[model samples]
Target: MKIKLFFLLFVSIFSNAQVVINEIDPDTPSTDVKEFIELHSNIPNFSLNGYVVVLFNAGSTSPYSGTASYYAIDLDGYTTDANGNFLIGNSQVSPTPALDLPETTLQNGPDAIALYLANGSDFPIGTLATSTNLVHAIAYSNTSTTQPTALMNALNLTVCINENATSNAANHSIQRKADGTFEVKVPTPGMNNDGSGIVFNYLTTTFNNTSYTEGQNVIITFTTSSNVTSPVTFTISLNNGNFNASDYSGNTIITIPAGTNTASTTITLVDDSLDEGDEEFILYISGLPVEVVASNNSILRRVEDNDYQISNFGTPLAPTYGNVTPTIPTGYYASLEGLSGSALKQAIQDIIANPAVVHLHSYADIWDIIRTADQNPANHSKVWCMYIEQPMSKIDQQQGSSIVGKWNREHIFCQSRGGFQVALGDTADGISIWNTTSAANVVDGISDAHHIRVENGQENSSRNNKNYGTVNSSTVYAGPTGTQGSWKGDVARSLFYMAVRFNGLNVVNGDPSEYNGSVPSGNIGDLATLLAWNAQDPRDDFEMNRNNYIYTWQQNRNPFIDYPLLANYVFGPQYGQPWFASLANSILNTDEIKIFPNPASEYIFISGIETPTRILIYTLSGQKVLQQELSTDGKISLNLPAGIYFVNMKSEEKTETKKIIVK
Candidate 1:
C-alpha cells in the first residue's frame, strides 16, 4: 500500500500544522497580535541583511509550550528561530549554536535586513528600515520589556519632508538607528521677516581690506543673518589670493529670495594690488544646502599713517539721515538792498576826499569798498554805512568800481534842481557862500561870498599893535549889512549862527559862516563843528603871512625855474639808498636782532629786540660804528670787537646787523 499512503499523508499534514499552532493566541489583543504580524511578514521589504526575529511567547498559551524567546534582533547576519523567525534562505539557521551572525548577515539572508516593526508604547518605538541588518525585536508580554506589540502592524515608514521644515505638515518624522543611522526630524521654520531669528547663519564673502590702499573704495558691509531661510546669493572676490570656491568659482551669482525676511547686501572691494598685508578674499555663496563657507581676512591694514586717524567709519547706528548748519559770511549783512544812491553818494565822496579820510565817516564808505576789494587793506574802514539806501541794483560790481565812476555828478540830489546842486569852476566862484533865500532855499542859497575876514583895518592894527591880534583874519568881512540874508532856520542852526556871528574868525580860513552852503545844507554842519573849526585856525594869519611873502618871492624870482624839477621826479624803487641797503640785508638775514655772549669778554647780551632800533658796533675791518639806543627790555649791552665784530641796528623803519665775537 504505498507505505500506507505516506502514513496517511503525514497524519493529514500533522493536523494542519497543529491547526496553525492553535491560531497563535499568546493572550492576543495586541491588535490581534498586530493583525497576526501583518499576515506573516513582508513589511515593505525590510532589510538589514537578516534577522527580524521578534517572537515572545513566554508563559505560553500552548503555542508549542511557550518560552521561545529572541525579541528585537536584526544586526543582519541571521540567527534567531526559537520562534522569532529569520531563516529566509538559509543564513545557517542557528537556533543557539552560540550566535554567529554577520557574514554580511549570513550572505544576505533577509537581504541584509533593516526592519523597524515596533509598538512598545509609541513615541518612537520603531519603524525604520534600510540597512545591513539589525532589528532584534520582541514583546508578546514575555513580561513585556517592549517592542513586539506585534511589531506595530509590521512596519511601513518613510516621512521626512523639510525644505526648511515646519509650517504644519504634521511634524514630519523619520529615524533609524540600532547602528544604521538616518534621523530626519524636521521642524525649524520660524524667524525670517527681519526680526532676525533662525540663528546659525554666517556670511563674509570676499570683503577684502587687505590693509586697503590701492584706490581703496571699500564699503564692505556684509553682516548677514536677517534670518535667512533662503535667498543667499553673494559672490565677491578681491586680492584674489585663493580664499576658496575656486577663487569665486563661477564668478557672480546672488539670488536670496525665499522667505528672506530682512536681508542685507553690500560688497564693494577695490584693491587693485599692493595692499601689503594679510589679504584674502572670496565670498562665494550658493543657496546653502549646508556645507557653508565664508572667509575674509583681508585684514584691512593700509590706512598707512592712518589716513588722518579715523574720525568715524562705522558703528554709530541711529541716524538714518539728517543734518544741516552752515551759513556764515559774517552772518550775511541783510543783503544790502541793491545799493546805489549814486553808488552810495559816490561811496560817500570817496571816503570824504581821502586826505587819509580823517576820523572816517559815511560809515567809512562801504568799509573802504570792502577793505580795498578784499585784499584786506587793514580792515578799519569804519564799519560801512551809507545811511541805509543802497539800491544801485545791489552794487558790488567789484564794489561798484569803488564808488561808481567817481560820482560827484555835481553832487547829485537834483529833482530838476529843486534841492541840492553844484557845478562851479571859475576857482569855484569862491565857493558860493549861501544865502540866496529861495529856490527851495538850500541854506539860504548861493554866493553870499565872504570866505574869511576880520579887517576893521586889521582889527585896528592888531588891537593897536598888541600883536596877539591874529585870532584869524585875512580881511574879507563885508557882511553885517552888505545884505545877503534869508539864511533861515536850521541849516545847521543857521550855520551855527553864522559861526557865532563871525567873532574873531576861523573856518578853514574862509568863513562865510563856514559855508556848508551846498549839498542839502552839506550834511548840516556840526561835524563836531567842522572838527572844531579845523582844529583852530588851520590857516589865515593873513593867508599865512601872505603865503609867506609869495613863497619868498617865488623862490627868489625863479631859481632854476622855481623848484619842482628833480628831473620831473617819479622815482620809486622804494626811492632811496638801495632801499636802505635792501632793507638792511633783510634785517641781517632775519636774525631779527639777537646778540648774546658771542665771544664777548665784558658784555654782549642784546636779545631779540624787534624795534627800539639804533645799535651799532662794527670792527671786522670795516670800522666807523658805535651807536646805541634800544630798550624796552629787548636787552642790550656790548663793548668792543677784539676779534670779529659788526652790530649795526638802526630803526626808524629798519636796519639790522650782527656778527659778534669780542673775547
Candidate 2:
C-alpha cells in the first residue's frame, strides 16, 4: 500500500515534466535484434513512475483502438540515472544498468512512439487519450510518406522526422543531439549523445555477365577498403524478374567482420522448361557504417535459357525430288506401321505430342535450326526463301538485318489468326528476319512459335495474317506478292502440321473466318484455295528438303509432303478410307517417263515409251480429261487448255505417271 501511494505521489510530481524520447533504434545490425529507445530528462534523478510508451504502426490515428496500438511498454518503477538518461529496449548484449523493455517491438520506422502518464491504471493502451496525461511523442520514418501521423496535434508534437533520408536502418540509430537536432549516428543506449558515426572507407559490387543460364549458381561479391570501424552488412532480394519464387534462393543479409571489408553470396537459380527469355532481377545493398558511401546502390542480374542445346541440331537430307533412299530416318514411324488415313493421323498426333518429342527450345535455337534447314547447300552461307525463290540473301547469325540483306522467319499460318501461344512443351513461337523480330519480342512468359519460314521482311510483313492466294485477287496479300510463284502446298501442309501438333481453343479449334473442326486442320486459310494450290504448285525439291530438315529436329513428318495423295486420304475427297500407299516408289520410278511441252499452252507430247500404249491426261483435281490409244512412241494429247495435268501411260507390264503444267 505504501509503495502504491509513493508511485502515485512520484507520478504527480514529475508527470508534467516528462522525459523526452531522445533516440530510437528500429532495425539493428543483426536482423531484428538490438532495437532500443532512449529517454532524457533536463531534471536530474527524475522518476518515471506511472509513465508508459505506446508504439503504433504506420497509418494509425489519434482515437486509438485495440488494433491501433501495436505494443505498449509499461514503465512503472523506472527512473533516469544521475546523468538524466533512461533507456528501454533490448540488444543481443544488454547495456549495463539499463531498463530492458524486451516486450517493446520497435519496427524499422515510419512508426509513432507515444509517452503517456497512466494515472495508476493498466494504461488504456487500446483506448483514446488527451493531452492532459500525455508527456511526449516522436514519429519518425525512413520513408517520409510512411510516417504515422496519429495523435500528433492532440499530443502537441512539434515535428515528425523523416529519418530514412538521413541514415541507413541497418546498423545506425536516430540520434537527438544536445542542441535538439536529429541525425543518424552510431547507437548510444543509456549514454549521452556524441557526434561520432559509423563509416565504410570503400565499397564496390559487380557481376561478371548480365545474363546467366537458369539452374546455375550465380556469385556476386562486394569489396571494401580495410579501414572499416564497424562491420559492414547489407541485404538483398530478387526485387523484380519474370521468374517464379521457386526458381531461385540465396542469402539475404551479407556481413563482413569488423576487421575485414569484403564478402560474397551465391544465388542458385532453378531451371524449368518455360520459354521465357532473358529475365532480370536486382541485387541491393544497405547498412553501411555512417561514413561509408556505396559505389553503386544495386546491380541487375539476367538469366538465360539453358534447357536445350539448340546450336548443335542435325542437318536436313539433301534435295531429292521423290526418292526414298533416305528412308524417313529408321524408326520414324515404327509405331504407326499398320494404320492408314484418319486413324494414322490421330496416331501421328499423339506421337508428336509426346513430352519427349516436343522439346522446349529458345527462339535463338529455332532460328539456328532454320538457318541450317533453309540453307542452299550449293552455297552454305545463303538461304532460299520458301515462297520467293530468287530473292536470296546471305545468312547472318543475327536476325533482322535489312530486308534485302537478311531473311526473316515467316509464319505461313499467322500466329494471331488463332490465339496459340508458345512455351516449354507447346509450339507457337520464330527464324530469319522474322526470327530476329521474334527474338526481340521474346518475353518472360508462354508464347506460341510463329510457325516460321525464311523470307524477307517485306514479304513477311506484307503476308501478315493474309491467306495464301494469287496476290491481286486474294482478300489480303500474303505469300509471293507478284508472279514469284506460290508455296500453297507448303503453307497448307505447315498449317496442317500446326493444327495436328497444337489442339486448343486458340489453335486448331479457333478459326475465325472458317471453322472445319477437324484434326490435322485444313481450315487455316481459304481451304478451297489451299487445296487448289496444293494441286497447282505440287511439292518441289526445296519443299521436300525443308520437310526432311523440319522432321530431323522436330521429329515429325509432314504427311502431305510424304504422300500428296495423303491430303486426299486425310482431308481430301477420300476422307475416311483405310487404303494407304507410299508415293515414294512411284516418285522413284518416274525418271523413265518424259512429257514435252511442259507448261504447255496448246498440247503436250509424251515420248520414250517401250511401245504404243494407252494414253491418259488427268488434271491435278483427279479429273481424267483425255483417254486415247497412243499411235507412235507414246504420242498423244492434242487438246487440254491450261492447268497441271498428270499423264498416265499404261503398257503391258506396269503404268507410269508424269506431271505436266499447262500455261
Best candidate, TM-score: 2
Give a tens-digit lDDT track for model 1, residues 1-663.
999999998667533431001011122111111111111121212232422433333222332222222333333543222222222211122111112222111110011112333332221223332222223221222121222222222322222112112243233222222233323233111111122322334444333454443234444444444546556555444434423332122324455565653333443333333323223342323334332223222222223211121111111111111121112124121222233323322222232122231121121132222222111111111111111111111111222212321121111111112232233331222112211221122321122111111112222222221111112454322113332211111111222222222222111212223223552222122122222222121221222222222222111111101111100010110111221112322222233445676667777767666556677664533454566687533545555546655565656645444455577
Error of 2 at 109 (Å): 44
User: How many pairs of residues collide in each model?
Assistant: 51, 23
Model 1: residues with Cα > 4 Å off, grouped in runs: 1-197, 200-231, 235-588, 595-604, 607-663
* lDDT (0 to 1) per candidate: 0.27, 0.58
Instruction: Indicate which candidate wins on lDDT.
Output: 2
How far does residue 638 in candidate 2 sit from its true spot (Å)?
17
lDDT of 2 by residue, 1-663 (tens): 999999998677664564888888776534454677888887656877778887756543333222255567777777776557677765332342255544225765556677877743444545443466667777676665553545455456667676556545566778887677788767776567873333225467766666677888888877775646667777766666456566788886888777777888888887887645446676656666544545444355666555432322222222334442233765665565556665877766666555554443444556667765676544444565665664353423334233433477776666555443454453324322221112112231122232567776666766666655433644544455464454556676666555555553122211244333533222354443455455555566666666667665555556666656555434443344453354323431345556786667766666666565677666555567888887455446466676556665666534555556677
Where is model 2 poorest over a 10-residue stretch in terms of lDDT? 436-445
